[model samples]
Target chain A: MRTEGATVAFLDIEKVVFTYPGRAPVVDGVDWRMQAGEFHCLLGRSGCGKTTLLKLAAGLLKPQSGRIVLRGGELAAPGPQVGFMFQAPTLLDWLSALDNVLLPVSLQRRPTPQDAQRALRLLDQLGLASHAQHHPRQLSGGQQSRVALARALVLEPPLLLLDEPFAALDAITRAELQDDLLRTCRERGTTVLFVTHDINEAVYLGDRIALMHGGRIVENWTITLPAPRMQAMRHGPAFNDYCARVRAAMDGAGT
Target chain B: MNPTPMQARLLAAALFLVLLGLWELVVRQWGLSALVLPAPSAVAQALWSGLASGYFWPHVRATLQALFLGLAAGSIVGLLAGMALAESELLERVLKPYVVVSQVVPKLALAPLFVLWFGFGMLPTVLITALICFFPLMENTLTGLRQTDAQRLQLFRMLGATRLQTLLRLKLPMGLPPSLRGCAWPWCWRWSASSWPSSWVRAKAWAPWSSPPRA
Candidate 1:
């Protein structure tokens, strides 16, 4: 995504700390901020609390020690402005692909034809337009993940929180979806905070990358790559440089 | 010919006749009392006569009315109770023991008392049917509601789904297909009430044996 005004902060998570009772804190005291339309990736290994941090942002969990503010409003719960996608496809398997995308709206009222049209358009954008009526079991793993991505975006939330949503996919599908997600988010100017363990994904997708170690963001980088990251970008020097930086931070933290 | 449908049916009919013939021959050969051992043909003939005379319709209608009313009422109540228990831990803690206790005692043991209170007509029979249906319906529906995937529940929370919306959109749908396996059990009980010899067992308990006159 090309930069417009990068000055406006869309999400500010201040000194957040969270723990499951009687255990060590999963997310230690940490501060992070994001601008509108910026795609930031929180890269970390398993159990380092990246997902917990995303959940806190989504208002699915409350941080014990700090607060998360969106658009100057302190969030006590998940509002309409933020959309979340979990690692699992998390689509209601009983629902069709189209209906699953329409789920966010369906909970409010009977989804109007307009809502359905919007869902169909999103499926179309994700290349799942033709499989709208198919059940989740009928779709391939990659196809199901793409449908989930469509569902996450169907609400047109200004902020999207994705926690390793495509971790289970094959390489080719993951790359294709990463490109689709980047293009879509870039076009809509959606502020995204995506979480992942893969160095290559964080390097390829994020406008800025934050590496989490031991429950805190230990390293953060503003990627200066041009818009429309391509498949060939993986073999490029700049991409390798970003990956090395992320990997070095990972190894340096020894987490 | 590779067993055509019509031919298969014909074969079935022929076997049925042969079985009846053997039954009749065995009864005749043994000279058994008809009351003790009616032949298959005799039973079929009696059944046909009852149907031909329209003698069975009112009785059938009465039984069906009881079954449907019992099934519908019992199922609706069971679902509501199940939902209430599943949603509230307090309610589950308070009421689940009572449900378990009720289930532990023989429900059929109470059926006769219902007859005494409600009279011998449709009300008592309907109560029996409802009692037979209540347990499975409540248990399965509760299990289904409780078994909703945790991730899906998280999704509901993220979507800001209200309690009703979460129950309807997520829990209800997820619980259905699996709970349906056990949910079907009530229907079996309902049919057994109508078609099976269950009433015979009841009657044996409720009525005195026929041959006795004590001096």
Candidate 2:
């Protein structure tokens, strides 16, 4: 693979390896890189270590070997510059939508007037400004996910990590959030490393899809489809070709 | 079924009236001595006089003082103990047996011992009240603290919250309502009565005086 220093590549993962205590290595020597403002997806079956790799990249898990560099600096503990959205909404049920979005700010104990204004603006952008006072229980699954997304993005982190965030939503809601997430990330020029098992979703959302099998990345394909991809892209030749390649890669690896 | 406040009050009043009428009828029909079984009217008169003479205030005050003191002490100790146990498994293992034994021992039996150790006045009463009050607060607070959602804890850790921050912001808040409920109002009332000596003043002062005047 050619190593080009593009202005876009924000994260570099070189020969990363991880193994749980008393267990075999879940992620063994994976080399992956993504550009700045890129939406990359890790696609695989369950237990393929896609989630584990995402955690490693987010600094939630330390790699036993190799290194992950974020903007040229070694990734350490999760900081304000990196936002993580878990599989669950992970919203504090007692807190209002606005308060949930402000949690990281409160934890850091550094919310300026501008930060508050930014939070409000982000909620507004996410279509949750009117539901600021509502609790997580009051919102639908889609709305809750949106609020979670708003919370994740409110801090304006350069790197956003999503772990199967929309896996729990219904089909229609998932599709809607997919589009919303794509638009939001693109507008902010945020680099997103998303993990999902859905092949269609991987192609639909990811600018580059990396297929993982047995804790290793066997294929990394970059999608060159046009910007603002529509649902019709799924029926196009490019989308079909990417899907076929990824499927073959997965099957070839006996995943 | 949940009764409305008005319905509950009406039911209580009807029960009180029925009990009073039955007592009155039994005493009248049996021609019992006033000393043995005072008429409902006589008891009411005595009660009124006791109230009017301001004899009940001092006892009420003493009882309330004991109750408040015991409640404050018990709640503080219980909360601290519960939090400590929740935070440390070694401490929990060492103390769990003693806590169970203390809770099981009859409080009334221990009352005299408390009096013997602490002496008369409000100390024994407050100690007894605290003993009675501690169990619920400890149990409830401990349960609440332990019942914290694991996912929430993980989320807090992921958000870079320290252990103390997680406890204070998440576990403690989650446990508060149950802890408050555990310290029921009835326990407060009992503690008040035990701690305050005022409730006994009217009974003790008037009992001797109620006998027929010397010839």
Candidate 3:
């Protein structure tokens, strides 16, 4: 993908602080920003508040201090512009794949003929067209995750937040989904803020990677690698170097 | 081809007849009196004549009417009470004690009160049945609703569903199986009410020396 005109800021997080009651801040004094059409990954250990940061951006949680602005609008609550894929697929087990994909629009009371077509197109794009009539329990884990991805994207949201979306899958399925997600997000120009603990995944998919520890972003690295990233890239020197740097940063932060 | 449940039931019935024949032979050899123990054949004759003459139909219909009306009223009230209690902690706290007390109180004692209130017709019978039926339905529905997966609830919130929408779409669907199970027992109770009284009288006739009339 070309990098031209992708420098415009799409989301800005400024001096955000959040804490559970009677506890230390889970996200403390964090400042971060993402550019339009960029694939960013928040890499951190468990309980490091990477998911908390994603929740804040998704407007699922409010920061006690500082501001979160999305597309120049202040993030207040969940809206149609932002989509979220939780760690679990969270597909309604009773709903068929097609209905699950159409849930965001249906919940918003905006499902029209165009929205139905869009849902079908999304299922096809995710290679799930044939399974549209199947329930979530009848689908494999990989298929369920794909359906969830379709649900998140069917509304044509500009911003997508994924909280360890592939953490439950096997390595082979995870790799396949990682590549599919990268290609799809790149083609759609969707600004993705994804959370993951895997260093290799952060390096493979992130255009810019942020390492978070103890509720703060300790390091941020931008990958200047060419698009159409392949598995062979993992063996390349630049990818290895980036992984090593991220690992060192994680170790230094004692996370 | 799969054997139909009806075929299975017929096979069970044949086995039951064989057992009944052996019991009749043993009783005849011991010279059991007709008043003390009417044979299975006699009972069958009574049942058939009762059916052919339509003498049982009115009683059967009356009992069924009471059972069905009671079931419907009990289920609806139980479902609404469970949902309302689920929505408000204060209501649960204030009304839970009364619900528990009602379950613990014997229905035989409560039956007279219902008869006094509604009089000696279907109303008293239906009211008694409903009182007997409500506890299981309410408890099961409440448990099912309260136990909905928290992760799923969070997903609904993230999807921007209102609280009512979440309850209707997610929680209600999840509670359906348990609620249906709770509703099943009223059917069994209906059948028992038809058969148990006659069966108890038959047993008493076989034990003739038990007790004389008090007055």
Candidate 4:
């Protein structure tokens, strides 16, 4: 969960519509706004276009019509300003963990020594310092996800877009990673748009949650639970209440 | 029960010795000419004399030079062509048929034509060897480049990577292992290629003694 901050719109998606070739609109007339430093989750069922919308925001896909503005300018193409995490970790199997984290920098030019140090620091922050030299094949699913997270955050982008990054991990590992992600993003004040189908996960990590159904956002909630979300909070009545509300909204959308 | 490693080794050694003895006896009894089938003992003796006199060194050097030079040239050309074809659809469509036809015609068949054009010595041999070595590496490299993970490509796109950066950083590195496997084809072909030139063209200093071919 993000701490309270001044209400400044960091990303503005207004009536954004996107349809694949010979297919119906996957993201249709979607309007969304996020304040700077917000941790927002796009909660949805499968094929609901939440992932499509996230991709559109990341500039990986273009909308059929509508403007996606970031920091008061059009976001026509992906740049260093937006960090992205795919559904899978997507780490290069040939590269060591440290090298994978340094990819964003190395793609442009030879990485400076400071860039390497920063990548190492990010890995350390994710509890992967010792595994820096280890390749993706040597790492567990959880460790690989952490490395992907470090890679996403390496450039210290102002906006982070993640599409179910921890969906593949086991429960205990997922919880640990959620905590790590929350703490890291909060420290950096990186505006996050996290997409997930897991209601509990959405409640646990988001400052605000938007329920997307049939390529449109059907419900939005500003989570009222106290800040500094803890593992214990998942079991609390407040958290369950939020999850229930989101679940009801989802069910309503299905009907 | 499976034989122990030492037992296996001894068994293999005994089999080899028995075969060699059979070969020696058959040749002697049948009055076989050396040209028809040289005895195993004769082969061993020749090997010993050749090495002992250092008569084989220059031939070995020549064969090695052709093998290495042809391999290096063939592989570099194949890799570059593969990169170009993989990057451009129009180029692949236009050049791929010619490339395929070139490979379809046997390299051995091409050796005589090469000798006619380039004349004797290493040049014609090297050309024939390089032609033989080219195709497999190119095809493998192209397949590898095209087979890059789609998700990984998306990741690169999201990072605003330039076309060159995407090719070098993502496509090329990912394609290397398969392309290296392609080198195996050229390696095996080089041996046969090394001997073909001397048979077709004027005998180089390293040419092994052999009967002339029927016209």
- Which predicted model would earn the best TM-score? 4
lDDT of 1 by residue, B51-121 (tens): 99999999999889999999988888888899898899999999999999888878778888988898888
Question: All candidates' TM-scores?
Answer: 0.85, 0.82, 0.85, 0.86
Q: Candidate 4 - CAPRI tier?
A: acceptable
Q: Considering only chain B, report the TM-score of each candidate against the true chain B.
A: 0.71, 0.73, 0.71, 0.71
TM-score (chain A only) of candidate 2: 0.93
Report clash pairs, candidate 4: none
* Over 4 Å off, model 4: A1-8, B1-31, B178-215
- lDDT per residue as tens, model 3, B59-163: 999999999999888888888888888778899999999999878889879888888898889998998788778878888778878978887887777878877
Candidate 4 on B1-215: residue-level lDDT in tens? 99999999999999999999999999999989999999998999999999899999999999889888888888889888998999999999999999998888878988888889988888877887777677888998899889999999999998788787677667776776744433442332232223456425534334545544556
Model 2 per-residue lDDT tens digits across residues A33-151: 88888899999999999999988988888999999989878988877888889899988776678878887776666456887788888878778889888978889999899988988
TM-score of chain B of 3: 0.71
* Candidate 1 residue runs with Cα over 4 Å from true position: A1-8, B1-25, B178-215
Model 1 Cα lDDT, one tens digit per residue, A1-255? 225975535798999999999999999998999988899999999999999999999998899989898977888898568888889998777667987898787655556799899999888988988899998889999899988888888879999999998899889989999999999898889999999999999989998999888899988999988888999989999899989988988999984
Q: What is the interface RMSD of candidate 2, in Å?
A: 10.4
Native contacts recovered, in order, as a fraction for each? Answer: 0.53, 0.30, 0.35, 0.55
How many angstroms is residue A98 displaced in model 3 relative to the true structure, after the best TM-score fit?
A: 0.6
